[model samples]
Target: MIGVLVTFTQTDKFDRSTLAKIAGELRGPFEGMAGLRFKSFMLDEDGVQARNFYMWDDDEKGRSFFTEELVDKVTGIYGVPPKIEYLDIVGFVDNSGT
Candidate 1:
């Protein structure tokens, strides 16, 4: 598995409510997305940052999803470019079925 962390540090231009609205609008595309195991949108209002965490079943698929064009599009939406990091998922626990 692969973990992708996308951080946006332009919270000065967008408040928590705005970020929440953006997340709500964008959440649908990720639902049932191929190769995606899980996704979360996060907010750090006090620290002035917004972040998205994605877990993908395949590293290639996760890495390929974040293209330059996608970065540019997200930059336009958040009013700043994001810092994206890809990580190896050593282990995880899921109890949603329970």
Candidate 2:
């Protein structure tokens, strides 16, 4: 599997309601996305950063999802451009059963 981390950072912090709205807005695009395994949304302790962690079956699809228009949309929403990173998943530990 391939993992992608996209972080939106800003000098000013966002309130919880705004974050919730952003998260809500995020859900629609991935509804029928191909090669998607899962996506998790995250927030920094300082509330100045928000992140999306995505797992995908196809690296190309995952990497190419962030098109210029999409980036512009995110930038328009959060008022900050995102920093994206791709990772190779070596292993995963699931403790949900425990």
Candidate 3:
């Protein structure tokens, strides 16, 4: 598995409500996306940042998703470029059914 951390700094440009609205609007497309195990949209209003975490089935799919075009597109969306980091998943626990 692969973990992707995408951080959008300079989030002070948009208010929390606006950021939340954007996240809400963008959520539908990712539902049931192939190779995606999980995704979360997070906001740090106090820190002026928005971070999104993604868990994918493999590194290749995760890496392929975050292309230069995606960067540009998200830059336009959030009014700033994102800092993307990829990490290997050593272990995972899912207790959704519990």
Candidate 4:
């Protein structure tokens, strides 16, 4: 599986509204994509940090969505640029989407 950790430092002017917009956008559709096998998200005000935690079925699926509208929505809302890192999910918790 392909696990990608998408991280960013929020701009000084970042607001809750923008985070809300991001959540809305990510939960929607684009580029014929449908699902994220597994996902999580986190934000740290003290560090001005935000991350998009994801685990897709494979590299192709992951890259396909990243190159699609999801990337645009992230860039549009974050104000500043972001960085991404790829990793392997050696272990994870799954509750059948509970």
Name the top lDDT candidate.
Answer: 1
Worst 10 residues of 4 by lDDT: 27-36
Candidate 1 overall lDDT versus native: 0.91
Pairs that collide, model 3: none
Question: Cα lDDT for residue 65, model 3?
Answer: 99
Give me the runs in candidate 1 sitting further than 4 Å from their true place.
Answer: 11-13, 45-47
Q: Which is the better candidate, 3 or 4, if ranked by lDDT?
A: 3
**Each prediction's whole-model lDDT (CA):** 0.91, 0.86, 0.89, 0.70
TM-score for each predicted model, relative to the true structure: 0.93, 0.86, 0.92, 0.70
lDDT of 1 by residue, 20-95 (tens): 8998999999999999999998987475888899999999999999999999999999888999999999999999
Give the per-residue lDDT of model 4 (tens digit) for 1-98: 77988887855635656676777776655323445676766676664777778788777777666664766767777765667778876777778769
RMSD of each: 1.5, 1.8, 1.5, 3.4
Judged by lDDT relative to the true structure, which candidate is superior, 1 or 3? Answer: 1
lDDT of 2 at 81: 92
How many backbone clashes can be found in candidate 1?
A: 0
RMSD value for candidate 2: 1.8
Selected candidate, larger lDDT, 1 vs 2: 1
Predicted structure 3, TM vs. truth: 0.92
State the TM-score for model 1: 0.93
